[model samples]
Target chain A: MSDLTAPGFPGEAVRLRARTGAAAAFPPAAEYGQVLFGAQCGTPGDQLDAMRLVPPVFMPQRLAKLIDLGREPLYQDVELGTVIGGFSSPLPVYVSALGSTRAAGGDLGLALSRQAGALGIPMVIGENVVPVNGYGRLDEDAGRSLLGRLRAYTEHLGDGPDGGVAVQQSTEDADAEVWNLVYSDPAARPLLDSGRLAFELKVGQGAKPGLGGMTVVDAEAAARMAGQYGLDPVFGEGRVLRSSSPGTFTAEILRQQIRLMRNNFPKARVWVKLIPGRDVAEAVRVAVEAGADAVTVDGAEGGTGWAPSAFTGQVGLPLAECLRRIGEKPPCLLVSGRIWEGGRAVKSLALGATAVGLGRAALLAVAEDQQDGLIRFVECLSMEMRLIVSALGKYAPGEISPDDVWSP
Target chain B: MIEDGPTQPGDPRAHLSSPATRSTLRIQNQLLAAAREYLTSAGFTEMLPPVIGPVTDPGGRGSKQVDIDFYGHRYKLMTSAILYKQASLLAFDKIFCIAPNVRLEPLETANTSRHLAEFHQLDVEVAGASREQIIQLVEDLVVHMVQRTIAALPEEFAALGRDVDAFADLVQGMFARTTHAEAVADLHAVGHDQSADAEIDWAGEALLSSKSSRPFFVTDYPKGSRGFYDRESRTEAGVLRNFDLIAPEGFGELCSGSERTNDYAEIITRMRETGENPQKYRWYLELVKEGIPASAGFGIGVERLTRYVAGLDAVWQANAFPKLPGVVSP
Candidate 1:
């Protein structure tokens, strides 16, 4: 390195020094490692295997037109900020649907692990599994199977040089019984340790704050979930399911899960993701107090795979307020919703967030083209990030601060 | 003077005289044309967004709610044009819109001097530019609009005994840039510490006594006090890339604007912490996904602007059918 007192490059040196300071402030890279698994809805075995070689592969749903091919091609031109996976927030049954088909050349877990290892992107599997219906009852078997599969899948994937898998969990039933299985599963330990596997305790999503999620529990799936909950399968098709049980008691169950994860996998990061709402601060306080390592906030503008018209269009909070409240907490803040570019990411970081996830933007890349599309998306976001930092007279992601923002 | 009297109900033209109304309509038309020309010359295109939104986002402060039935679904009416700001960030690089907005204020008084339930706002936004460029554009547009309007109102100016040239000069002079800190310091220099935690009776009394020119920009607001999207000055303290065009009249603030937040992660965190879900805004986020060029924009309150120009004390006087407290009929 050049002399620290160099005239022409002192600014550069100072910037480099500041970047080093920021890196020091950041938790160890492995501590923040997130393993995102792309459980492509009905992805083919051959295509899934192909993803294993890529650094980090984001799998979009297998289109109806391509499902019969037994080889789904990844979008090749999408960028980093593009949204992947389902447009609407995924439901538990949705994951169940993928899981049921995973046996038939759709092993979402193996694909996620392989693609994560290949692309060098952390693995986070969006498992929209719920264990309850609109009527109070637990879908034990479905919950157990989903959790078991996730645990097994992460373990099978093992930890790369970086870390393990991060499971994005959306539970329908918040009872202790349901969480007990999720927390106590034997396979979850190793994945949680080595910082490979983690848990995302989802409360309300940005697309539908305070609105319960619905699962089109098919006859067979309904029977499985109902049997686990000890309920007679008397209800017909399209049974609506609420995620949280009676009162705020469900929060306790999440707390227990956090404790269990920490105790079992001391290095694993636990995050609680909630939609922006009137009561977000209180909710975040609960999550933090509940022993969460970080909190992920989703704004009303967040994309969902499918949601009620009212919930998607009329409910929840916007991103700005979410950042303001979450800023109060310095923990690892992973935010999602409609994040598209580097400037947006920089803005969030400045306002006090560790990182942001590209759900819709990621999906859009895959939907528009394939893996190339996804790569293009990431490139576009990275370029934007660099440009924004340069314009703000800063270098690197760490130097960007909230002081750089203002209202016109 | 005509006595205030009750008129027959449900009659559209019952209270109007054709000759007077015709002249008023003609003048309003002329004013609208002048304003439109000024904005168009400034390179702003007219655009519109869905008036009914899912929730009130961060930029929406002091906004009103309207109930509208959309294809069997009922939705609230928009209180301001801020919603269009985000939409404009997506579809158009630079755009403006003149539209009606509704708000529900429970504190209903019969004064009709400073309040209105429904009004029009001349909402303008520009992207892909810097803060300095936007300020210059706004100044030019305001000057153009005022010049044209005054030129067309020779009879009114003469009747009011107002010096048209002096008025024009005053408007032009106020455009000279000044910082908020400087303004506050000037106020303090006059022997009043307006910074006191308690209300400064002397400061308020002095300001009320002053006959300052109407229409000027208040630049460089405190960073912590500004909205989430504003860009803070790179080289100043307590100053954001923000400006408020205030009119010396009942219409206190005519326009409020600032540069937007361009950092992806910061934007996300702000949205989430504020209880806003980014999932609903996939398209909006895409604009910034690759990064956004430096830009700034502002919304000019149409009713307030018109009220200032027309010398109307109440906002209701500027609207065709003003909605005020407890007044159901137009």
Candidate 2:
């Protein structure tokens, strides 16, 4: 059949031709996979836990694997229905998470990307990519360097036909597509096509929201990312100021990231993760408006390796309430918290989440056994899902809708 | 008593202007002084912790509605003096504090005099001690406060025409020792049918229903039934090293005391099992790790005690700014 008149074709005459041909062949629901990949990394195992809580002075190849997990084939699988990639640490290591000052030094983004690639998982990255004066300070030069490193990694993954990286700039500074474009260049297109590139606009993290991120601004690294993203150069150990709290910087940053992603790779889906709070609905609305393909609502119950007790316990809304409110929107929603049992994940989906992310549980699995442990954890969750489904007389994960939920 | 005027129902201005029959301000001040002195003599340093905590770290029980700005930050009022108790353990070996605790009560009934929206507690904590020490301290303090009250209000007691002999006999009788088994046997001896398979609540009811005189201590509780922090008794019965100071009339339990757990590893394990983060309480764990001496502590319901002493029916009568049901302060 001609490409134009072929079944499932996008162009004109495709509808007319369908009337003369038999129904297109499609696989049974049970035959298809529902998992997707974003990046790769080591399973949170005993080995990692046993590693002294010290900073990584010298970057390890394993760190690179983590970053790769956040790249193409890994993230592509996450977008498609195969095996869902667990998004681990992609941001700079904080003192709390690492437990030492040395591990705080290395290229955190690169390390995370490589890890994601190794694990064949798509990881979320870049919350406060910009530098702030007091918090996560980054100069124009540092920003440029960091963007350059990201661009180099994306290019290495191979983006377009020429095998040369493609660079698409956003129309406006606040456009979300700006970061997406940078990640979807010709050099990175290969990874994007493979669903390894899962672009995200991080509105709020599990840590303090009003406060920006903190990263040791290496001039060389900052220049790389800055140059790649078309920002001015940064210099020295001086900190960079990104945005201030009670400000519109978060919304602006999200818009820019979305605009960039759409301009570069329209096929790839984008996500925005936010902490649940009293104004969660409003935040979700903002994310949706910024052109997020999906939204993740991280509840106060969600665990982080390190965060102030006050922020960890008091800052965010509960996952159930957040999901219930955000589910009003049509976008795919992912919820995180004490989602251990299958009932919990199913309950989350039933409450309006398209999926649920497990941080501590996943870490526990990895810490206990490594990759095998993580796989086992997932299996346990899947089995739990199956049992719950059978009990409810439902089949697919999508079948576990809000209709199955009941508030206590 | 029967003045006739236009019946302005529920009008504040039209109500009887007669003076309060029970002027308790002076008595209340004197009682507070006496309680503080007694606590101090027991080696408790006075302290005060922040009234506001992160909305999320509500020590225990249900979630609280915290006041926040447009950004959704939450600041909850202190629910209890437990935080201060925990903090004071770090500095003073023995400490005590009197503070107001607030909580929203949906089921407020006329008979619910014990459960108030807000109440006061004379919270105390002691480290480096034993269950016996806690019992002695609580018993002595209770007696001392009662004695002080009697001495200060001879005229009032005389006016009420209450027999001092009855009060003295009641005080002396409570100082006597009685085990849980003995208490149970006493109840049965008095024709209160208590089965061996009965729950603690059933036993508690049997004891409360008995025509026991004055105040007494209910000791040797089952370890599994009490909070995880309570120390288990070393005796054969495996009971918890805890006791409740029960009073006669309307006052049920005026004080709860126990020897706290000092084992760091066990405390962490228990906390983890309960799904509470041990990291958040790192400071508290440090104390146990440093090998703090085994101590016993107890908290007295200041409001309950005052209410009993003043012959007041409700706890609100003891509190200066009482938060009553259906009443919102400006």
Candidate 3:
């Protein structure tokens, strides 16, 4: 091993193991592979900004929503609606997973899927978007493929029932099976007959947790991913990199890959995600005891496009210590990292998550306005999550729990 | 009900001299002469199909698939000659066609009064049949095309006033069935949560066809909600021996058969488990690997059965050059 040395580490790992000789065991952007990683200017130590939502001096669900709305209930009566991974989201925020890199793939991922489907929430769409954009072809022009961000998120997700999309996939989208082509797409049958679809799975993404997914391209897209991914030319002869792999699960192969994605995409909605590892709460208790329907996680201050700026400020664990090691009844739980405003999404919904995602702050609010900057940055994070859930006297966002947070 | 007809780029034959398009084309020619007198008196064999293909029917519901450029090889067009009614059941094992499909659909199903984007189907099949014999031959072909279009057009269903007692419980005997987990638990007992693994949502099939008054079906479904040519129900491990039918007072679905996947290694593992690309079904899996029979088909639509027997409130007023979906016309 290049003269192994373990004399009490750090000296910036011994002057980066003497300027990365033998690429000092990966990272340091494996010796600069045609760079791209963005957003990184100090902002790491997390634990949901050392918590604190704490309100209760007497609130009994705002006195049962002020005697069931016979009066006093403002903060727009809270209810930033929810249901994420099973869709119906009008709020508890979503948008996360933005893959195929080059700063949030194609048309800024269809203008963040047409303003997160006209602000109804839920988005995802990450991983190598159908092996780099092309699971489209319904006689062409479904640009930015993955059925053009599922037809710009179900044609501006109008006919209510909140929003939804999900997608994800990875491991080179299971050799382009990308959830069996978005579960047998007919442009994903109106989001699988209106359950608004979902699929997710991925396994590890916060910046670069346990690696896989690297992007960089251009050697004519790494010679069209010559023999499917893991390209490398050490990002040189006209920039290449590519890569993918990080797949290899265990908890019974992640419970038989969520029972073969519920016996092969039984009308989608499965989810999963995970990464801020250190057994991110036993992989969210084995993907919600193998049935998933939303799990996410991310954390290591998530945000990527091409990592190794020391796995974007030191790899994994942070979205408030993966929601304090996924505690407090995490069933749907989501969470992300560097979440944009609404005080870290109502302090990751007062610490038991169930929502908060908006990754790289929804690609920097649709790169600052691609038709209403992520709808006025989610209408200023849904009016700062209804004035922080009606100033913690709560009215909805599932009545903000963990005794409305407060850590040391 | 059959009113629409004015495209004025110089009124191309103003809806063929309307009188409500001549009583909706005389009740769609006795609903295509009672579907060719009930599939040639039940023996079948009609055929005409192939309106350009190399592959069509990639299982719709969201539609899109017009393509053409044929001489240069990109074909397509017929969005439902359901694989040429399963390769014309190997030249004959009971067939039927009336095909002509186009499909670009979704423009939010152009105001959903039953979409069109150019249509027509009636498409049957048979060979060795059985998904309970094509759901009893599509409920005796929709009660022999509504008793032969009400005895050869009762004055075009009384000049389209239509209401032959809405086919009293569908010409009596057998029409109501359900199972797609009891129409998704009767659309989650009226709250309409539908999706018992999908295929029911045009507003939950118009809320289970406006709580049915006749004509039903629904059946199995679930194996990833269709099109690896349906099949997959060897004693139900995810169901799907197919079905749909619908059409009651709400006038929705009107047929969508199944029980197909004719073996060639389960049609190449149901075309790679429904993501298709079995090399774009090379000549229909080389004629289902040199064989093609195990049928049990269905198609229906024909302007949604002439807009539910000419009671026409939409399906483009039961056609005559309808098209609709994203509009634009000739």
Best by lDDT: 3
Once fitted onto the true fold, the runs of candidate 1 whose alpha carbons sit more than 4 angstroms away are A1-408, B1-27, B48-50, B53-64, B67-76, B83-93, B106-112, B156-168, B176-211, B223-227, B234-239, B272-282, B290-293
Worst 10 residues of 1 chain A by lDDT: A87-96
Cα error, candidate 2, residue B210 (Å): 5.7
Compare the candidates by DockQ and give the number of the best one: 3
Better of 1 and 3 by lDDT: 3
lDDT of 2 by residue, A260-364 (tens): 334333444566666666777877776677566666666766543334457755676666667666657345666666554455666666666666665444433
Residue A136: error of model 3 in Å? 18
**How big is the positional error of residue A210 in model 2, measured in Å on the Cα after superposition?**
33
CA lDDT of A158 in candidate 1?
A: 29
User: Candidate 2 or 3, higher TM-score?
Assistant: 2
Which digits, one per residue and each the tens of the lDDT, describe model 3 over residues A282-382? Answer: 87887787678889887887664667787877777778777777777677888887776676778887778878887665665565556666676666567
Candidate 2 lDDT by residue in tens digits, B1-330: 112312111223322221221433345556678879988876779987567654222222111233334344324566565534755677888888877776543222213455455667777788777777777777777777777877887665554343445456455634544555666677677677543211133335435624445677777754323444666665654366777777665456677677876788766644432223354455557767886666677778777776666655565555555555335531
CA RMSD per model (angstroms): 25.4, 22.3, 21.9
Who is ahead in DockQ, 2 or 3? 3
Which residues of candidate 2, in runs, are more than 4 Å off?
A1-408, B1-22, B41-43, B54-76, B105-110, B157-166, B176-210, B223-226, B234-239, B272-282, B286-293, B325-330
Could you give candidate 3's per-residue lDDT for residues B47-76 as a string of tens digits? 888888767776544355666677765577
